[model samples]
Target: MRLLWPSLAVVLLLYPALAEEHNYQLAGPAPGSIRFKWIHGSICAATNRDPRVQAVMYNEDTYILRENIAIHYDAPFTYLLMGNKGALLVDTGATEEAEYYPLRATVDAILKRWGDLRGKTDLPLTVVLTSPEYLSENQGYRQFVNRPNTTLVPLDLAKMKAFYGLTDSWPNGTGRIDLGGRIITVIPTPGAHKDGVTFYDSYNGFLLTGHLLFPGRVMISNDADYVASLTRLKEFSAQHPVKWVLGSQIDMKFLPGVEYMRLIRYKPDEHLLQLEPTALQEALATATRMLGKPEVAILADFTMRNRVGPDERPGRRPANLPRIPQLPNLR
Candidate 1:
């Protein structure tokens, strides 16, 4: 696998923002048409030119929005929705005006495509943000404010209260959203990203995973709760059998410096979908590797890199740790 030197170097320096926050914008074109740029690399290239953005249309109706937004680091904002009921949007693109150009237009195009639902007069539409990144950074959401009954659903209730305006509820775990007649089930998976989550469309076994399960990447996880959240999906899939593995971002070649601009869809049953089981096993193993190993230093290093102004990343440590003696055993 090719490694992103800048990303890895930033990681080595332990910059929290490099992993958590993205700083980039759209490069070319207008709404309905867009190309993203790697702001970091653009400045470093000898040509001092923007990196060519690759756009991959996952399908006619299903779009990986990140395909249109600048990729700052490893992950990109991804959205997935089928009609209104089974709408499973992954990540909200960036939080800036430049990045919002295509993101807002793409969302409008999606809503317009699903205009058949006659009940739009009432029961307004709810755009669910699987995690905070989808909502916090993406200022484009402001465009949806005019829509009737438009509400933003987040994962953390306290954060929802602090930032989001429309809806004040944070998804605790598994919850159901009645999108008119459409159904969206939110499954909280908090490991890879803080308060990160995924949504399963009960209507069609379509699993819209954000940064949780990016194709060809070792789900960079550390926090135990997030790992536990991912484990829950393994158990759920064992019972429910996810038919489709729809990801936000994917690079088929796994080559370095080759950015992916498309969503990779895998039809398990159709293609003998056994890869998920293997992938799930690997994800868990990675999480287990962190167990008993103190991650405070990693967290501290990440914070130092971000130049976190004042507020520190907040969350309680998992209670289940092996108790070690205060001093060496006297034998």
Candidate 2:
């Protein structure tokens, strides 16, 4: 009977992993079924008195933590993905004031809860930003730079390509990381956003795309590069099942053909956070049709605002453009 108990325990442990793999074929939760589990209330109804960082349990292992718009106008959304071996925190949001924002503390609280639920202690945290510019734009990098049991993954093209084993080909260049049983594919997409990259969680069928393909103003820094990225994204999506395309910021207003003002803190009636694959294809088609044209193009769900000047061409930035601000020396 001693061997029987051990065998039974092994089966019990492997069952979840096996079942998760089987369910991946189905992609993710059913349509209209993948709603965010808000801690307080819906986005429109949530009171301003709620916590600055509201944690919404996206799924059993994935948590979508949104920064309060009142705290920062951008109010970017960060993701906490838990795995058997460790946990991954994607994006820090636009809050430099750690005392007021407390992103690390909020992450720690979620990690603690995750650890307790899994009967594990001190699951290492791997912090990764979608873009380096977020270090300046978001200003939340300082809060996590010196945290305990945390490793910040650099968002460098060469380094990330090597780390993820992405190739120069269409889908082969995509990097893959095994977060325990869950596998995340990292696609290097730089154009719409600087050093832009997208993370695809195969387990949950989530494509955590940052500013690259958000619903709001998708400022295209380079037309050619952005088109190539979109083509690659469309091809990648064809091969894999994408349940949700989650982005950092949302600028679409509740009313159709309307948008929120820039740097506006409060978003009373905003659009939904999640987007579908068709939206990506539409963006791709729009970019393909306006390949040589260096003018801004507005689509149904998003606007492709081109920032390229007369002297600059696609895939290259203007020489005189101001550089992104650097983080203060945390050491």
Candidate 3:
């Protein structure tokens, strides 16, 4: 699933028009288009000379790492939150190519750089996935599952509930995890996506929503649960000043209404990385209105599609669906 240079050119040329047609706000060519250097607030293309994982500093204590689109079309973004005691890595991305997806190496480099800057050393890293499905499906997880001073927390509802002291509250409970000087609230959100959870970074005022509300298709497995989750999310957001709503994937293009191709690894005109709280409010409103209505509803930014019957199992893809063709390796 590698993208060659020539195919990359084709995608760059055609994406703008496609994005415009769908009303996505086009943000020209990605950063480093000419010289391929890391640029803040731009999707920097990856090269052999540079590591596949590109880390962009969101703030002094937080870094957002995105996998090169050429390596995996999904190109999911991971969050690294630094604290006085240790660091927390949100998700391990969607790449299985060990050579291309060096998540652990990237983390080590970032930690070293951060340590040098702050005079801190040997900070433990705790890796937690939005869902356990990522462990078996994403090869990126392999890089950190056995590393030293790293703890890979499982995405078990019961275990997490107990650890966070939310056993009494169960699925709808909120638990607090103190990472040294930083404190984050973990809210259990399990319906929109199985084992789905949201991490609220109080210091940064950022809501890290994993698969609950991204810019693409928000698949609702259970309508009742989805409604409850969104209601809780909205109420929680109202309590805090949410700076931005960050999600794992960006399916919307830079243009307003355009969506990226599901299988394309590279997104030249991707939407802005962070979504405002208003977007979440709108989504919550839409979901609230459709509480007892049909299972499927379409919104401007995302589609509310429901999965029912026997196919609701996690990691199960419908049979006979056409597979997206992978571009051959150009290098």
List model 1 lDDT by residue over 165-272, tens digit each. Answer: 323343344666654344566676666556566777654455666656545332344456656776787787777646555544443222221222232222111111
| Shift in Å, residue 5, candidate 1 | 65
TM-score of 1: 0.54
Candidate 1 weakest lDDT stretch, 10 residues: 297-306
- Model 1 per-residue lDDT at 114: 45
Query: Candidate 2: which pairs clash?
Result: 94-138, 166-173, 167-173
- Error (Å) of candidate 3 at residue 12 is 50
Candidate 1: list runs displaced more than 4 Å: 1-61, 69-75, 84-88, 98-100, 116-124, 133-139, 154-156, 159-173, 216-222, 250-277, 294-331
Q: After superposition, how far is residue 57 of candidate 1 from its true place, in Å?
A: 6.7
TM-score of each: 0.54, 0.77, 0.74
Reference-based lDDT, each prediction: 0.45, 0.71, 0.68
Q: Using TM-score, rank the candidates from best to worst.
A: 2, 3, 1
TM-score of 2: 0.77
Tens digits of lDDT, candidate 3, 167-217:
898577788766775777888777766677788887777788867887765
lDDT-wise, the better of 2 and 3 is: 2
On residues 161-234, what C-alpha lDDT tens digit does candidate 2 reach at each position? Answer: 55556535533377766667667788878776656778988777778888887767777777788888888888
